[model samples]
Target: MKKSISVLAATLFLLIMVSSASAARFSIGGFGGLNLPIAQDDASSGALFGAKGRILLLPFLGLEPNFCFAKYGGKDVDDVRGKSYTQEGGDITSFGADLVFGSMSSMGKMRVYGLAGLNSNTYKREKLEDESGLGVAFGTGFEFFPQEMLSLEIRAKYHAIKVGDGGKVHLEFSGGLNYYFGTE
Candidate 1:
């Protein structure tokens, strides 16, 4: 926990320093949504929440550091021996950076973008050891800036964690509000 806190603090400081100097565009936001599991027969839909720091390097390019947590819904099943078993939901936490493309639509009130990045993911399950590994994440989003410094955003994200023989793939649909600082 201490190590994670330290890394988060350092990352925030670096982002602030870089953004302050550039004075281009900087924002902080948080989101929550549904985490839907695909191809993983044993897993079910879950709750997802996350936060991000966004730094726009150019009008059409940006960098985002994000953290997310998702919890799976519970399931019950019986083994091959016909023994009943209660299966609890699982959870995952991920931290990562993304490269974003596109921004500020022609209408001037909307921003649409796509992001892809690498993440450090940790998976936890009931009655099982926790697993940690690297993953890839990709997402698309649209934000509407109704006010000068505020935006309402909607996004869908996909993650592929390399843990099992192949990988664990999941998708998340979410909404958030962001507060921007600095100039355009």
Candidate 2:
């Protein structure tokens, strides 16, 4: 895990250094939405919030660094004897970076994009040991620019994380606003 994080940091640093020379635009945004656990019996749908920053490296490619916090809803489980018990939900805090590719042109008011990224996630829950793992995410979204310096965006992403011998998977749908800095 340490080695992987080091490599990721180095690669991001290199990309930023190379792209900074020609980067034309930058933006920062915050989003909030629903987080739905997929095929999981111990968890239910919850809420997620995050912040992200975008650096345009080319006309159709950009880099985004992001942080997110998500909650899992508690579930009611039935025991072997038909007794019911409550399974408490957990929380995940993630930090990651994404490569965004799409049509980002000034000629249109709307831009569509696809993104893939990797992240480090920390999981915390009651009665279980806390753990950290690596996660992967891929998604697609669109941005609508209603003004020269502002954009309204909506996205849907699939996120998966490795846990102790198993894994957790979820889908996130979010909406946000971005404020652009420099020429768009």
Candidate 3:
């Protein structure tokens, strides 16, 4: 945990310093979202949340790297005849990157954009087994500005986590805050 915190802090500090000196286009931000899982023969839909940081490469475009922590809520059903079955809600952890294509107002106020990314997910079950899978995702969202240096956004993504047997599809929704450092 200490190592993760240190990495986050260092990255934020670097972003602040770079954004403060360079064009206003450079900024850093974090986000959290909910996850919904599909096609888990033993599990139900659940919630997911995450955070990210971005560096603007152009006035209207940027590269974002993100980390997401998610949980799937589910229940199991059993048949009679003295037999018991297990159904469970699982927890997932994911990490990935997104190439963000969006446009902000000329004054750096409100913005709207789309994103595509590659992600990996790990699923955990109690007293059972764990699985890891790779996924592709795409989503879109809008950011609203209340201050020149800060804004809020809501985004969503569709994910396909695996191919072939026991594959799953997931949809997630999230919201976050962003800070713009300089001028455009």
Clashing pairs in 3: 24-182, 24-183, 35-48, 76-87
Worst 10 residues of 3 by lDDT: 1-10
Candidate 3 lDDT, 1-184, residue by residue in tens: 3354455456545654664464446556777767777655566667666767776756666667678887777666667477766567778787766667877434656678999876666767788677777667899988888987888989888877763255767788888888776566
Number of backbone-clashing residue pairs for each candidate, in the order shown: 0, 0, 4
The sequence of per-residue lDDT tens digits that candidate 1 reaches over residues 1-184 is: 3464466557656765775676566789999999998877678899999999888766777778889998887766767598866578799998877777896323378888998876778889978998877778899999998987899999998988876556889998999999988666
lDDT of 2 by residue, 1-184 (tens): 7887787788878988987898878899999999999999999989999999999988888999899999999999988588998788898999889999998645488999999999888889998888888899999999998988899999999999988778999999999999998885
lDDT of each: 0.81, 0.90, 0.70
- For candidate 1, what's the RMSD? 3.5
Q: State in Å the error of residue 102, model 3.
A: 2.1
* TM-score preference between candidates 1 and 3, better one: 1
Error of 2 at 165 (Å): 3.3
Candidate 2 to truth, TM = 0.94
